[model samples]
Target: MLAIGLEGSANKLGVGIIQHPDRSSLEHNKSVTIISNIRHTFHAPPGEGFLPKDTAKHHRTWVALLVAQAMEEAGVTVDDIACICYTKGPGMGAPLTSVAIAARTLATLWGKELVGVNHCVGHIEMGRAITKADNPVVLYVSGGNTQVIAYASQRYRIFGEALDIAVGNCLDRFARTLNIPNDPAPGYNIEQMAKKGRHLVELPYTVKGMDCSFAGILSSIDLHAERLHKDGKRWTDPETQQPITREDLCFSLQETVYAMLVEITERAMAHVGSQQVLIVGGVGSNERLQEMMGHMARDRGGSVFATDERFCIDNGIMIAHAGLLAYKTGFTTKLSDSTVTQRFRTDEVFIKWRD
Candidate 1:
């Protein structure tokens, strides 16, 4: 089965074409081949966040070009496509609409089925496809979402989630406070800084039951950043006696926030009695997070599953794979039902493909 997927729920717009083999060729097992994956990002300047209006414009300007480029790269004709897929929700409204409209246009023009995929489920299915992780606890983290999930009863049930702002949002706002670059991603730049850090500054760690919170941590770190800026950042680290640098703040924030995530994920794993844990979403691309999760999983006698930027960090291939799974299950979004929203929950989608 061949499908084209368009993803633009955030600053990055992606287009991908992928194909799944027929069971007649590969019996008892299935494989997915990514024909093409193209992405275009609309990053804000240092110390700024991307606005919905500007992000929507970016998707509108690049969607057609990206789709054409993906088709060329995939070397596929329009007739070969079985379906058109797009992210449906739990993202910025304007950007989601922009991509959804493009997907609807393509579906209508090609006379193909339209599969509306949940952004979080896209991440989960793509991670599973890449890592071959079967029945693992899922950690879904991104700019707009922070969730710990477990699969049961044809549903990806949420074990825990952010009570306020998501972890990526906290990191991005911290990056803004420090005026760090957002070219690749704010979290990535922070991870780079965290590598050079020796001192761990104390920050609030709020884990309420299974859920976690990051707004307080962001507030605390932002105050520290403000004070350091006022002092020209010449403050001394009490532990190392070395100067407290911005890198230290990044390191501390990562350590604290990641610990909160690990704690909740571990609890979910214990509850679900799953050995493997799969990390998904844009923040799942963080090496630090993967390492920390690996440590926790190992201690529990399990493994941590993660993907690189191509799959983990919000791309079209994931949408294509997940949407195709739904399409194969005889699911298609009607023209009247093809809409985008900012508040679609992860558990809202029924996982009919999974046993």
Candidate 2:
């Protein structure tokens, strides 16, 4: 069977086609294949973030072209698709609504069923499928979400999460403070800068038991940057008495925030008695974050599983993979029920396909 998925939960608008083999042809529990995955992001200028209205307009403008290109690349006609899948919630409301409307129109135009997928669940399922990490502790970190999740009693239980802004959001806003380019992505540019850093600046580290907070950390970093920019007071290492650069600040922020994420993920692993860890979402693609998670997982005699940018960042393929799982379990979203939301919790979706 085949599925066409649409994803526009944020700045990126994606269209993907996926194929699922029949039960007889499936092997080793691996049966899903990505036919094509195409995406275009709405890039905002430096020191600015993408607004929902503009992002929605971008999605509305490119969704059709993307879908057409995806289908052409996949060499599949609409008649070959079993369902049309789309992200339903936990994202910017305008972008989500725009994508949902496109999905509804496609479903009606092609006479196919519609599957509404949870944005977070799509990441988890895609991570599990690509890494083959069965029942691993999941750390989902993206622009809008930071969560430590695990499967228990047919639910992806949220063990820990951000109390305020997400880790990626913190990083993106910090990049804005430095007037870093948003092309490709703000986080990617920050990571590149952090690689060149040698000093680690002290910042607020707020972790309340399992959950972590980034709003205070972001504020502290922004204040420091402002002071450095306005006063021209050289930020120097207190011990080395050496000047600190913006790269150092980016490095320090990544280290501090990623450490909090690793700490909470470790706690969740201990709570669930699972050593295996699977990192998902856009922030999960950071090499530094992955290395830290690897260290933590190895300490527990386990391992870390993560995907490349193709699956890590927001894409339609994850939605197709996750939605197909739900569709096989007799799930469908009616036209009337295809509403979008900005706060869909991960645990709200019942994992009917998992044991």
Candidate 3:
């Protein structure tokens, strides 16, 4: 069976086609084949963040083109698709609604079933499918969400998360403060800069038991940047008294925040008595973060699993994979019930497909 997925939970709008082999052929390792996966992202100016209204407009405009492109790349027609999957929540309302509208339109026009997928669940499912990590502790870190999750009683239970702002949000906002380019991605640019930093500037590290907070760290860093800009003073390393560069700030932020995430994930793993760890979401693509997580897992006599940019960042394939799982389990969303939301929780979904 084939499934087409539309995803625009935030600035990125994606269209993907996936094929699931017949039940008899599912015994092989490659049961699922990705036909086509394409995406278009909306980039705001250096000091600006993408607004929901503008991001929605971008999705609405490019969704049709992307869908057509994906279909062509997949070498399939509308008649081949058995289901249409779209992200249903935990994102900006306007973007989610825009993508949902496109999905509904496609389903109605093609006379196919509609499947609603949770954005976070999509990430987790894709991570598992690609990494072959079975029931590992998952750390999902994105621009909007930061969570450590484990499966229990047919639910992906959240063990820890950010209390105030997400770690990606913290990095993006800090990038804006430094006027970093958002062409590829602010986080990627920050990661590159961090590699060149020699000294780590101390920043506030706030972790409340299991949950962590990044708002204080962002504020403190912003204040220091402002003071340096206003007074024209060169930030110096406390030990060597050498001038500190912007790279140092970016490096410090990544190190501090990623360490906090690794700490909480380790705690969750110890609590759940699990040895394997899976990292998902956009921030999961960071090499430094992955390195840190691998070190932590190795020390615990375990290993870490992660994917590259294709699956780590927001994309349609994850939604398609997850929604198809639900569709196979006799789940479908009626047209009347296919409304988009901005606060859907991961634990809210009943995992009927999992034992």
TM-score of each: 0.97, 0.97, 0.97
- Cα lDDT for residue 126, model 3? 87
lDDT, residue 265, model 3:
97
Per-residue lDDT of candidate 1, residues 1-355 (tens digit): 7889889999999999988885223211148898999999999999999999999999999999999999999999999998999999879999999999999898888898899989999989888888888899999999989999999999999999999999999999999999999999999999999999888888999999999989999999888888689889658756667778898899999999999999999999999899999999999999999999999999989999998898888899889988888888788999889999888888999988777
Each model's number of backbone clashes? 0, 0, 0
- Runs with alpha carbons beyond 4 Å of true place in candidate 2: 23-29, 231-234, 237-240
Please write out the lDDT profile of model 3 over residues 167-246, one tens digit for every residue: 99999999999889987899999999999877778889998988999999999989767756775645765666777778
Q: Whole-model Cα lDDT per candidate?
A: 0.91, 0.92, 0.91
Compared with the true structure, what per-residue lDDT tens digits does model 2 show for residues 1-355? 8888999999999888988885233331387788999999999999999999999999999999999999999998988999999999899999999999999999999989999999999999989889999789999999999999999998999999999999999999999999999999999999999999888888999999999999999999897788679757457666778788888888999999999999999999998899799999999999999999999999899999999999999999999988888888788999889888898999999988877
Evaluation by lDDT, superior candidate among 1 and 3: 3
What is the alpha-carbon lDDT for the whole of candidate 1?
0.91
Q: Which of candidates 1 and 2 is the stronger one according to lDDT?
A: 2
Where model 1 places Cα greater than 4 Å from the true spot, the runs are 23-29, 237-242
